[model samples]
Target: MINNHMLKRKLDWDYRQRCIYMTTVTVEKRRPLLGQLTGGLGNPTVELSDVGIMVAQCWQEIPTHVPGVSLLEWQVMPDHFHGIIFVQAPQEKPLGAIVGAFKAHSTSLYRAGARQEAHLWSPGYQDTILLHRGQLANMRAYIQDNPRRLAVKRAHPELFRIIRNISACGHIFAAIGNHFLLDAPVKRQVQISRSVPPDALAAAEADLLAAALHGAVLVSPCISPGEKQIARAALQAALPLIVILENGFPPLYKPPKSYFDACAAGRLLMLAPWPHHTDRRSLTREQCLALNRFATQIAQEDHTP
Candidate 1:
């Protein structure tokens, strides 16, 4: 039986709709047969191995085999691949079918060339549906810059790394995104979203301040103008905050001036699930919603007794 912790993709969701899709597939056992990551901190590059070159060629040919699918940005890493695919029209096959076909073809070619019969790909993959154009741009930049981030992580694993299942204040949170660590236990955390109205923003800000007065951590993505105001207020008041970001944290990342003191006080945590992009300036609607969902999840998990 599949562990309940593993979430199956929505089987009933329609994939024929015209939209942008992102998917990631890793090699079996995460072997670094695809490429070698090299270069310095800000200018990392990927040197494709023999297998990596084949993977790239196969990825480029995905659009040719898959009807109604157009390839966007993609990257072949040391042991994984990240690609953006756009479904331009309705099709008989869904996104999963296209991915499966690509995987099968790639695996066959790889095994035949390498003279190995072992499985080439791990089971299942990670995917996301882009809701708007902003997200597409963000994802494109992210895919293009994976090697640079990987290089930095490899060079400085102690400074920039993914820490899994961190427990704070009786709550378990994973640092999969760009985040800074705070060692405080969370108390009275509240969810703040971009959709809150102006009047509601004031009330929410007041409530957040009151909660802070009573020692509560403010959790939010702070993407909207209104939500940002609350975050600014929380920073000024020296209240603990858990800010969810849309992009990955850069190497030796530090909080902004507004939140510097709070971070220094060990009352701030920033979380993201994306790799650091060198030129990301905006967040897409889909990214905002996802971060808000994460914020809500964090709030729900902060159930301190």
Candidate 2:
């Protein structure tokens, strides 16, 4: 006999264990105080490597302080920080207490510096638990690229364009430098030396599709961390055997309805391996075509122009 309020609280509190989480903690003024420490533009100037090390150290400190909690990679941006904490609900202290302790420790250390200014962080924080595997990768990218997101917002000004458009085009798209993936083995293979214009993109895509079509199984890792560039690239190329590794839940093979929607709507088609089907190499080109046709039919039936 759980009351409504207790049931709701239980539902919320149940997000522990391998439940990947994303937390964005901003500064008091969004002052880019984190940048002062990691952006290479601040007074005491903190290098990105140094920030990474500091975050790692903080992560290590958690198990000792709160027990049953493990730290994951995080990014310190100009104005905020994004981190993931793995909480083992069985043995860990309350999540709120753990977060507060971590924040207090970091804020104390940050403010103790000789150049200490206003409060190190804004009030409270934001958190989302990863119930699905794809969300894990999405959260990783969200944390690492907070600064890039800010830049895009400031430079573009029109947030609407960013929200509506999903394709990659122009020089800015080509000039991106990615090292988000830990231990990049195939990065050199994917780097494009020249700027490709929109008009010629389709021709290039056809060529890419032809090249990748022969493979029985194609594994396409999302851009290091969770950057969507590689996924977007694969979508643009219309590669048939493509698979996207989303969060840690194993690769979801069947592309989400939203992903297929983009393809049917004349945008790029970013297909991945369907989930629960382990033997990907078993999928033949004919099966791929059949799946694609089915996806098209579904999209046409449900999606509006």
Candidate 3:
């Protein structure tokens, strides 16, 4: 039988595989000793400190130290690093061992150099197994834009701050981005089915865009393709939007670039009724119904005092 602890944390996959992985290794106690985020809004970059430089150098040497593992890309931030590692050939060492060795070596260097901290990194790095097409491109773009995104979030902290105990409609949710968008007088749920044809979807999206232009907040789970289209249109139009997510917000969660831009513009709100989790899960039928119902309830109820 699988233990609860294993269920919560383990991926249940053979670690020795030729797989591509995206990993995030954070600094101990979330310190910003890695580097300073510098430059203007249009052109932001990380000015790596001595510690940050050492971390980058160690990361670059991973391929040399770990057999059959090669580096794809990496970005060093104020408190953490995001990197993509390609295991082109199966190695005796698992991903965890590889990351562990990297951390151990980095700590040894820190100590040898007489750094104040006993260790450089926190325990247990987070890894995402890249299994789908286009995911690599997306992750690469995400890694590339970390500096700029961090700059935007820092500049507009109010828009991206997580606000809890947000009572909307009949339910309560934790939220991020433009909470005042909740108070908008008019809101409509974008409920487009998967069966919707392309032409029909375009027409429906157009109608929703018209409503959004007339000061309406478009709420959606963004489940189906049509729903995604509608949400994308609303975002492109720079109108108010409310998205009901299946999973709750992670503590250090930052919205992706597209959503980040909308949040920075004070036009987006992501609502989550569930607690945060790390496990990858499929959307069950029950979850779909609940989210759709939640979206409808949010749209119908008035949030204004």
Candidate 4:
């Protein structure tokens, strides 16, 4: 039988595979020690403090000390660091070990400079393994735009607040960046974009709305006209919805008149994985398809029976 402790621990997957890795380390208590965010909305940058510069140096030196690990890209934020490390070949140590070493070295330097005995980083960093080329590209964009996203969030704290670990309806969701993950007990359904004939859009929209009205959470990027129609219907019916956005929420995101009622009723959740792009535009085919896949995955995680 799996013990509770074992069940709670994340599986130690083999880290020798050639793949892209994304990781984030936050400062304990989320103090803005590493850098300061500067600039206006859509043009924010991080000005590294003395400690921040040291942190960056430690991260840059990782490749020299760790075999088979290449630093692809990295961004230093106010209280955290986001980096993409690629494992080019099998290494003697795991990816976690490499990260641990970097964290220890950076923390040591920070403590010595600050002349304090407190922890620098919060325990246990967050990591994601990119399994596909498309994911790699998307993650690369996300990391590169971290500074700009932080700026947008600061400009509009009301919409971009990182509501961490929210529990709703027996599910725990990590609402961070612009995306949300429904950890378990997910109820999922798929509505393909541009798949419905123009004449059938009304009926398809009604069907989707009916699913949500019946307690099936509607999940989508809501990009297609038909999908948007369904989203509007869900709002009108006061049904719960999980919307995936192509861009980050605008500063002080006030829902449009159409969505205001639903949002007020606590029946809407908007999610996005990308930074806010000031030049808002239509979604690319790849982005539309990727978000649809993510919706399906969320639905599949629903184990409620």
On TM-score, the leading prediction is 3
- The lDDT per prediction is 0.70, 0.43, 0.86, 0.69
Task: In candidate 3, list every pair of residues with a backbone clash.
Answer: none
| Model 2 spans with C-alpha error above 4 angstroms | 1-11, 15-18, 36-60, 114-118, 160-305
**lDDT order of candidates, top first:** 3, 1, 4, 2
Please, what's the RMSD in Å of model 4?
12.3
lDDT of 4: 0.69
Q: Which stretches of candidate 3 lie over 4 Å from their true place?
A: 1-10, 115-117, 303-305
lDDT of 2 by residue, 1-305 (tens): 21122112224464435455666666566664444443321222334444334544664687787656676657676556677877655544445566667777777766666356536666666666667867777767655554544443344333212121222211011101111111222111122223556445456444444544543122232332221343455555544322322221221121243343333332232332233222224545565454444333322232122
Q: For candidate 3, lDDT tens digit of each residue in 1-305?
A: 22222123355878789999998888877889888988958889999999889989999999888778999989999998899999999988788888888889888998888756586777677777899999999999999988988898889998888877898777889899888877788898999999988899889988999999999999999999899988988888888899999988866788876799999888999999888776679999999999999998888877566
Q: Each prediction's TM-score against the native?
A: 0.61, 0.43, 0.91, 0.58
After superposing candidate 4, which stretches have Cα over 4 Å from the reference? Answer: 1-12, 162-305
Scored against the true structure, residue 124 in model 2 reaches a CA lDDT of 68
Stretches of candidate 1 above 4 Å error?
A: 1-7, 159-305
Pairs that collide, model 1? 177-272, 177-273, 178-249
Q: In model 4, which range of ten residues has the least summed lDDT? A: 1-10
Rank candidates, TM-score, best first. 3, 1, 4, 2
Which RMSD values do the candidates have, in order?
9.6, 14.7, 3.3, 12.3
